[model samples]
Target: MARSVDTRGARPAACGLQGLPGAWRAPFLECAMTLAAPEPATPMSAGLFADEAGCPRCSWCQATPLYRHYHDHEWGFPVVDDRRLFEKLCLEGFQAGLSWLTILNRREGFRAAFARFDAEAIAAFDAQDVERLVQDAAIVRHRGKIESTIHNARRVLALRREFGSLAHYV
Candidate 1:
């Protein structure tokens, strides 16, 4: 018979298959395993998981400190700034085949490499800039994505001229 586990409250975050004593880790891992199974025996609600402090959060953000931080601070918040909005557009484009974690981890590098996502500055990027960015290890370094970012920056300028801000454009 399949067993049922109650996952209603906050649980320890040390659910990974590493670093805890066997006795303590076993049950947590079991719970994690149950949640991770391809077809969960029990229906879990809304993908919510409580942190060590007992605050509920999205399940996907429980994997890493960076994800948790992003969940707590940035996720679900409203953004209105044009540059920030444009930055998100470019980042989302870069994130096509990759995980959001990968994009988030390299956000700073992307900012540095892409002129802080300034639409005007990026719209002016030339072939030399594309060559330099294609060799950059910090960002994804896909020539197409780099070129798309530049192209989109120009589009953003057009949108900004028509609509007051990228926020308004969207």
Candidate 2:
């Protein structure tokens, strides 16, 4: 289903300062503050192109290119496959308390650490893997998040087996 972009109620005309009473005008302008005008809606099929400024906002990417790429290319679009969904979820977990840039700078390390984010491979990660990851300088070395990633990978795999795809679960 195609979603409508609602422009209604999003803009207010500027008050003509010359004609308004000073008291009424300052209050009006202050209250009338609004979001910057939205760009024309893009086609839905453009994949993640809808929010390409990458500022759709995920708590972590405050002001960085990595955050931009992730938001523009990965966040919030529908996912219909299991492995890909699991990968994103795993990354989101890693981003739980840290800035998105921290994880993003280590994204390549993350991929390598989690074996390209393959569900089966990640699910197989054990204490040894966790230990190796702790020693790795590429990714954030948080033990709890690391453990949770593996646990979540297994859960996603189970969901895929039962539902045929994680996207369907969503």
Candidate 3:
């Protein structure tokens, strides 16, 4: 039998194999088990957990500042504006193989590299501009996404001309 340390009874006695007295057994055992067990992860994304009021803890969002900000501030929000919708479509497409945090962090660079995501401006870009964008390090340099952005911009422009606005068209 292992004897437990006693410091004027302030410290709880260990619940040995037979367990401590009923008064102390359950609570002491619980505390000991709790201390040894991993704490449950608290949710952080409010939109993900309705019962938690949107602050659902997500394993992917562990501790990165950019990820936390995007998760809390931007995820799941709908867009109705043509320009904004176009921008998000391009961004989400660009984010397909990469992490959203990477895209979020480089968003400003993307805006700069893509001419602020302006539909007309991007639509005006030629092969020369495509080459320039490929050389730019600020944004993701993937050729497919880069070319797709141009194609999408043209699509948006056509939609705008036809429907008076992409919002109404969509």
Candidate 4:
């Protein structure tokens, strides 16, 4: 009882970015479209690995130390903390055009640069903050992504007030 998935025009609702304003979400659509497209059919199993690892993981995560550690320690694990959730959101935005490993290596730098991902704090980041972040070497210095983080922080606060928590909202 298997049905095929039509990856074309697939909605990005699953990524939770659908409701965001166009300007806020425009940059992500290309990435979403790329992700939503179906890969060439392969006779492969999704859970191709499991055993002493304690959980089955997607094959892509097997490639590097950072991905493996993230898969085992963080990925797919339930996240309930608001700050961590906010951090992940910003990190994913920063992840555009960059490898996740780059972000992982600079996670602490991001935390420090963004005031530990406090929504209220980030929402209040002035122009000076944006300029400083652009010059920060440890983290990605893309100005647009830095500004998006601040914009998204304000959005997070609104969502939090409406939904009780960003985790709940997400």
Candidate 5:
């Protein structure tokens, strides 16, 4: 006995796989089916709100351009680079009592002060570097957070040696 799949009125656009070659259909469908669908938005749901462009977004990211850009481009995306992973960990530590937006705004400054989050470079940071960073107003001047970042950098090196990369360890 043979069962046939009904293909009546099926449009590729509806499946979001339009313009893909026929060979991709099966794999794409398989992957798509395995992922959970997002919940439908409701008027009472405070989780989502429309931006000025009418695109629905998380409510917290609507306050500024930097937040919106970060939400759209970086948030929720997986990062595999060791430096970026280290940067994220350091920033989250710095964000303990502050808004993420404040960190995002000064991200470039942090990068500059912390040697662009390079684990090897930051791992070498010493007392003089700490003093230099404390006087720098570009990033958070909290000595504890700065020290933690330097300490974490050394850990990152250890993780790299054991796990091959931070992404793999994570």
Candidate 6:
């Protein structure tokens, strides 16, 4: 039988995983390896798990800097902006079947391609726009996802008008 490590016994420091007990190490490594499995979207951004600044963060983000910034700046924070809320909604949809980190890496690409996720602009997208998006290398190339973005954009228009903002509607 495999033995379990006592997390309480060690002081987690630096890369948080390094401080885990021996038994915990293998399981943690296994989990990390699973997360590293190849997917349609691979994260290009990486970050530190621990630094001198004393910011407590989830050790998982330490695997990549991109995740670190997201964890520190965006994760668990309340978002109030209407457009930003809409953007998050769309991004979450794009995340379906794709690694969240991969979506994180390509967020900029998505923003640029989709007019920074302006629902009004995206609502105007037509078949040609989808064709253009499917061929774009910076963002996910799935045809259904591209079309879904446009469809959702149109739906969001009514929600925005009714709720006064995407933040409120959501």
lDDT, candidates in the order shown? 0.74, 0.63, 0.65, 0.73, 0.72, 0.68
Point to the candidate with the largest TM-score: 5
Q: Say what the RMSD of model 5 is.
A: 9.9
The prediction achieving the highest lDDT against the true structure is 1
Worst 10 residues of 1 by lDDT: 26-35
Q: Any runs in candidate 3 off by more than 4 Å, and if so which?
A: 1-59
Q: How many residue pairs clash in each candidate?
A: 0, 0, 9, 0, 0, 5
- Model 5 per-residue lDDT tens digits across residues 1-170: 11122222222243342322343232323222122223442242446654443344568877897987776556765566677788999999999999998899889999999999999999999999999999999999999999999999999999999999998999
Per-residue alpha-carbon lDDT of candidate 6 for residues 1-170, written as tens digits (9 for 90 to 100): 11122222222343343422333232322222112223344433333222444333556877788987676446654566766777888889889998999999999999999999888999999989999999999998999988998998888888878988777876
Q: Model 5, stretches more than 4 Å misplaced?
A: 1-44
lDDT by residue for model 2 (1-170), tens = 32223322311233211212332222322333232334553433323222333212333434576665565344544454565667778888889878767777888899988999898898898999999998889988999889999898888889889988787888
Task: Indicate the residue-level lDDT of 26 in model 1.
Answer: 30
Clashing pairs in 5: none
**Model 1 spans > 4 angstroms off:** 1-44
Query: Measured by TM-score, how close is model 4 to the native structure?
Result: 0.68
Winner of 1 and 2 under TM-score: 1
Model 1, span 1-170: residue lDDT tens: 23233445333244432322333233323332222323445333567754554445679988999997777545654556677778888999999999999999999999999999989999999999999999999999999999999999999989989987889978
Question: Taking the tens digit of each residue's C-alpha lDDT, what string does model 3 give over 1-170?
Answer: 11122112121123222223333233323222111212444332333322122223234555586765554334443456676778888999999889887788889999998888899999999999999999989899998899999999999999999999987988
TM-scores for all candidates: the values are 0.73, 0.61, 0.64, 0.68, 0.74, 0.69
For model 4, residues 90-131, the per-residue Cα lDDT tens digits are: 999999999889999999999999999999999999999999
